[model samples]
Target: MKIAVFFVGEVRDAGFNASALAGADVATAEGLAEISIISGVRYDQDAIRARLAEVVPEVDGLVFIGGQGNITTPEIAAQYPGKKFAIVQGQKTGPNLASYDVLQEDSAFLAGALAARLTQSGTVGHLSGHRVPPGLKGRAAFVAGARQANPDIQVLTGFCGTQDDRTVTKAWAAAEISAGADIIFTMLNDARSGAIEACREGRARQIGNAMDWVEVDPEVFIASAIARIDLGVKGAIKDMVAGIIPDTPVHLGLAQGDFASLSMGGDVLDVHKEYIAKIAQDIRNGTCTVPNTYDGPEFQP
Candidate 1:
């Protein structure tokens, strides 16, 4: 089967896009299908629609990479009902479409808890590039987790508007730091560099998402919310190859092996790790639930 993996941003972003591309590579390497990548589309509705119109006819199926697909992909999928469709990190589903979400919120909540425990100023920050559902859920989970760990801890959250613009992210990060946030949790793509620079210069530590930022930069990252977006991509492609369109969304969380979890740096204390572990278990066992939405005031950068 000829399948096209669609992405809105640069696939080599070393973050969310990169993880999804890795999954596509795995699927193609497994001989499951002839996978082609359709990437570099800006975060624009008309551009995405035009690209989809151009690509859908040429491929047997299309697997969209992120929550961005929740809108255009479904509209396009409905137009092409005979063609199979899937969205990794998406919330929507249909008879001819499936959405696979690797619950990054699970780990984001843990990051919030850790940040609350580690913060000396009693204020932590959250900065993401987009206002998408996944990022919103992550922000909500982080806030919920921090409140759970320390009710008095303050969370200053913002969406800076671009996933790849370093200047914007840096400005936002610096602003958050200046506002007494000693720890910041960031969900960004290539723009993460901007946050790292701001954290380094401001003497603030950071928590990252998508991939393990702690493994990438120990000095800047105190922890990373590991969400296996790659697995979701691979699963979507594998299902497409098998000609199986799931009736329900494919939901993978901390309980589902290593699909989602938190990776801490050397700065994290043993006691904190134990606490996070207990919380993870509670979430898995249905004793705790992570919030999937945030309606609070947004920090303007």
Candidate 2:
């Protein structure tokens, strides 16, 4: 069997994309599947449609990794109605399309809780890549979690509008810190490093995304909400290969090991470990509900 994975941005050095690629590699190893990966610089509907038309015929299945906005766009879906497609972040329901959405809000909530517990100034900030649903959901969940931990906590917010714009993001992080935000949470693809730099320069703390950034900024990076998209993609491929594709979306969360908070590499502070453990248990026990970009409440700003 052959699978084609279309990503929104280049996966050359991105931690999140690398994780998804690792998942794809695992699927190939187990199922003897041939995989082809493609990435575009922007979420151009016409471009994605043209590319899909050119490549879909040769592949057995399609996997859209990350970039919730671009993958869920109506234009792309309309062009490939009958093609078997699976998306990682957002929900796009169709006859041949399935979504393996990550329970990001839950993970973000945990990160926020940890940030609140670790912050010394009682002020946390969220640096978003865009004002889009996924980014906003992460910020909102973080705020929700932080509030739960400390109602008096002040959560500042900012956005870079795109994931690749590191300069603007660094400026935003610096501005947030200048405004008295000591603990920062960045939910960007490659912009996480820029936020880390701003934090390091400003002498603040940060909660990294996708993977921990302890090696780069150990003193500042308190934790990371790591996502493993490979498991979901591999499972989708298996179902498609077996002709067992489900009519409903495949939602992966802590239960499926698709998302979690990592304390490895000294990314998580010792003080926040207990809080992270408790939140992880809450997610597993269904007591703590995390938000979904598609199903959760819409966020403004």
Global lDDT of each candidate = 0.92, 0.70
Candidate 2 per-residue lDDT, tens place, 151-270, comes to 888788666676777787788888888888898888877766677788889999877776656555578776676665666667767776765656666777787664655443364556
RMSD of each: 0.9, 3.3
Count clashing residue pairs per candidate.
0, 0
TM-score of each: 0.98, 0.87
- State, as a TM-score between 0 and 1, how close model 2 is to the true structure: 0.87
Off by over 4 Å in 2: 67-82, 264-271, 292-301
Assess candidate 1 and give its lDDT.
0.92
Q: How many backbone clashes does candidate 1 have?
A: 0
Best by lDDT: 1
Residue pairs with colliding backbones in model 1 are: none
Give the winner by TM-score: 1
